[model samples]
Target: MLLNPLLSLSRSPSVLQRPSSLLRPLSSSNLPPIQGGSSSPSLYCRSLVQRLDHDAFLTSYFWPAGRKKDAFFALRAFNIELASIQETVSNPAIGRMRLQFWRDAVRDLSNGLPPPLHPIPLLLSQTTTPSTRDLTAYYLNQIIDAREANLLDPPPPTLTSLLTTLSTTSTPLHLLSLSLLTPTPPAYITSSVQHLSLSIGLTNLLRALPFHLSRRRAVGLPLDLCAKERVVMEKVFRIASGKEGGEGGLSQVKGLREVVWEVAVRANDELMTARRELELEGGTGFPVGKEFMPVFLSAIPARSYLQRLEQLDGDAFDPSLQRRHWRVPLDVWLAWRRGRF
Candidate 1:
């Protein structure tokens, strides 16, 4: 499966687009008009199916037209919804409970029984087949594992430890899932997804660092290294955001932002390097020249957004940094419409 050349193309930036006003809270006018009939099993199932279709519509650009595209998107959307529950829930206990619910749902699906009435399970049922069922179970188990691991805020003793945790927590499931689904998943897919996931995850982590740092400070944890990483990360963010100056800003933060930037840069380079290596190996399903545009475009804006966060925060790390960096870039929208990198 790795021999397929088409899979070699980099994911385009266009794959990230959604309607600009979609993020706004639903209002009465925006809400669907109410109907008089009671919601039935068919109605519920149809609604869930529509959601799956909507998810495919939103992300189909990342995938070429094929059965794989349809099946993968359906499974991916379900995974995204399940994963979001854990991240969005404020209480760790509640998050764990939701994770367990998903775990059980996976088992039920695997047993040739339909999943429970939850939207995710309902959606999964529409796409379920014997071969895909195990894949779904594997993906859900990985999410559950990640959730369990995240319940505690353990400080890594070394950089290796941090990377090890990230690989185990964040990388494997997606890679394995795509690998299983695609007739042959190009090496670029794994490399790209890993790089993209790490970049986004780390960006989110950096945004939350201020809160973590404050908590650490209160308890008097030796945070010199953490502080330095934050400084480095901020520098990377600034560079990404098109801010003035370069590494010179590194000194201003006492190295906190420098540390963070170093982490992000290293992570990005690792992914890019892996991609290069994959491209060297007979080059997968599609030629890079044709496929790379979308991938590069999507990635640039995401990288820029992280950099923007650094600028918005200036020299200091702010707890609410994410909110400040939430706006989608114009390039991202353009890429989405173009549907190619």
Candidate 2:
């Protein structure tokens, strides 16, 4: 899905109007039956998420088997569906149309019905009971609105605007995942969850930057941060996308590495804050239970990614940072056992 095109310093700061919050009546009866996908419900969602995005697969790999995996796969499948739009579509207008379709689909799901035209929402609906769907309906639609908000990239954002962008686009998914893991989520940890989710969202935004610029020729870096380091968008796009092929692409930019470090430091602060909040002692948040572990495991990838960014010395276009590192499985395993991520 189009990430929060980050709150651009040059762009207008218009917030998304939530259709879910508006309380408009929905005529879900007109929703069509799911069509076109041959895979079974769970299998379809599972395969879709795995093929398109393996991070969630690794995160959910540690979850206790059965219903939890099914539910999370459905959730990540929907996320992948939204995330792929900007990368795959050549035209922004077509992307908008597809996003509108998903907006409608989420509304239908909120009404205890999912559009039959798409397998993702259909399978997601089936994975959970109607009552469970009802509870998650608001957050579900929020994600659609977040995707819709960023369909057209605006100006580079301020740090505040960037975080707000993520609070909607990313934070809700974490909350929903936690809900899926346990019906009775701890009330006090909402702040911690929001912190961790926002941090992960920012980290992913950084990870996806090269892709965003390469696929669409647009940079999503917060404008304020880019300014402090005088990052040049066009050069960054070429280098990060590997279109620039001298030995040292990172050296081409004047301050790209420093810009990346600024963002990384902010992300690191958020990550450490989340860890403290989730700490079992002298912390404001609750202890993470084994059942709740999978939802929080996202921190592992975020941290590993940050470390990689550091390794590259903040060169946003470094080739070594593009591929998955060898130490990821070990990082994930250690995080799982320690309940630290």
Candidate 3:
């Protein structure tokens, strides 16, 4: 799978070095405490992910302890903040300003300083070493750039366009996560990560389609597929909002189910491609390495969502689809125990 090129920044090594003389204790003004009065940024990130990104939070357990896990949560927390902007803000200008703040915050991180009182940046600044700092900032900035473009809320014209757009939005975080594990990941590993990230991204779009439709946001579904299926967004919106009898009216669209199936199939295909890359010559399809298991394990929930979609016969608006899968934790634990996604 092809991945988007990451944006690179250049700065002097000395510029990244912190001045020892200026170091001072954090206070309420410089470091606002999280709810419940805890000042720990890692804890804040952990709480944020646990609340808004439960699947990622669960998969985080497989990452080895210490700085790697801290970096993992920080990246996820940053993503959640960006992803939530379009939904939370009343206007695009506000969303753009928030994304710009993150862009500047990323610059501060590269300069070896966390933006004041921001838990995610605080944790990121703490976790990054000189070796990892530049790449981390690059990855964060790439995500910010992609999300800033997405704030315009353009529906992709084709499935190819959708994947192209999502490749930048979703793929970099996986790459950054892998970078945290090893500066030089094997070629196969990087390829597999790209496939998995796209798979997860596609699956997430499917799951969120109804919610997006209800809000009258740009349909996350490709216009080509929607047109091929004769899917009317107005009807989809009516069904999602219960104006036309809710999910029970979904079948009235005729082509919507097929469109959803086609997208879900593409998502599954990406996951399968990743699996094929990891298969041993004459063994079970489990991957060979334990060190990268945490990253690979992310595919579990994505796969599970795709499977659930299949069971629902490609119905994207099923209420049950919005609920967390009760079996995800057990599935993740088993996958981790077996050393594969």
Candidate 4:
């Protein structure tokens, strides 16, 4: 992972030039603009989720019609809203203001009313009805908090730190989805979802390597690992940003492939761990996986992604990896049939 160095937004000339409207408080008079054109809030949220995050959209697409599927769309849309703030702004302070608006919106949702115009927060507010079970304010806030951390520009400085950050985002979404299936979650089910969430989240981040490299602020590889592997961040960024110098740019990044392989290996380890945890706990007590397939369905795509990355020799910036239409649904359906993901 090669990321841009941190820009000193506080003292930077650009921050002063950024519009004051970008930092205004969120209220009826000052609410930030939201992407609102669908026929209904649910339609808006579902389309936004599908359009922005196809991988996650597929997870909910297979789910049978139920309140749980609705919850998945609301949650996924909320994630996109927060994740896109940075992309939508020119300055870090502006991005933070957008995130703060979400935080305030979450606060408003807790008060039994979200902004009337926005779809994500309003849909999220609906998910908190008395019957929604363990989908609590705490879990939603955890996801928001994690996104808030990344709002600063550049990602967590190391792989270990990065996992810590992702655990908040992915783990909460997975656990909350499982919780929607039942009010009182089993211990093993909880543990397995947590592990699987990290696995899926890490894989999701790894797959976005190219996109991140092209961004102004690129996430750097873990310093110690880079030092040990003799990986060069500059070369990694150049190849990743498609400025590959035309001389096998991926190969140019000394030991970057090894770092990516280690990440893949760890993801594989977590996949196995999740399966083991589910079997050990759910197998002995109840048929958790069979009953709650959609909650765990994300793991299938995550696994399929790992398999594809392996084929590319663990090169995160492989040209083929960037190609759209990777038969993701078929892979997920196959994994679904195996009762594994």
Q: Which candidate comes out best when scored by TM-score?
A: 3
Q: Check candidate 2 and list the clashing pairs.
A: 1-82, 1-83, 7-157, 8-155, 8-156, 8-157, 9-156, 33-116, 34-116
Tens-place lDDT digits, model 2, residues 1-341: 42222112114222211111111112223222333363577777766554445457567677767877878877887887777676567777899899888777777777776456566777767767877877677887888787777777675579889888888878888898988888876664656778888788777767755555655445567888787788777766677677876456645577766777777888899887777766544443444667777877777767888887787677656655555555565666666777667
Ranking by TM-score: 3, 4, 2, 1
- Which pairs of residues clash in candidate 4, taking residues 3 or more apart in a chain or in different chains? 3-218, 3-219, 4-218
Mind sharing the TM-score for model 4?
A: 0.81
Tens-digit lDDT track for model 1 on 1-341? Answer: 53322222222212222111111111223222322212233344333323322222233344444444444444554545554564356677887787777778878988888668665465555556676677666766776686567554455655566656556544554454454345355666656656654554444355444433323311111145556444344343454344746554433545554566655565556445545644555655223332333333334334554566556544334323323222333444445555332
**Order of candidate numbers by lDDT, starting with the best:** 3, 2, 4, 1
CA shift at 61, candidate 3, in angstroms? Answer: 1.3
Task: Identify the superior model by lDDT, candidate 1 or candidate 3.
Answer: 3
**How big is the RMSD of model 1?**
9.8
- What is the Cα-based lDDT of residue 6 in candidate 1? 23
Provide the overall lDDT of each model, using Cα atoms, as 2-decimal numbers: 0.47, 0.67, 0.74, 0.65
Evaluated at residue 2, the lDDT of candidate 4 is 19
Tell me how candidate 1 scores on lDDT: 0.47
Return the lDDT, model 4, position 151: 69
Candidate topping lDDT: 3
Task: Write one digit per residue (lDDT tens) for candidate 4, span 212-284.
Answer: 6665355535566677798777777776677767476664478877877887787788878887787674454
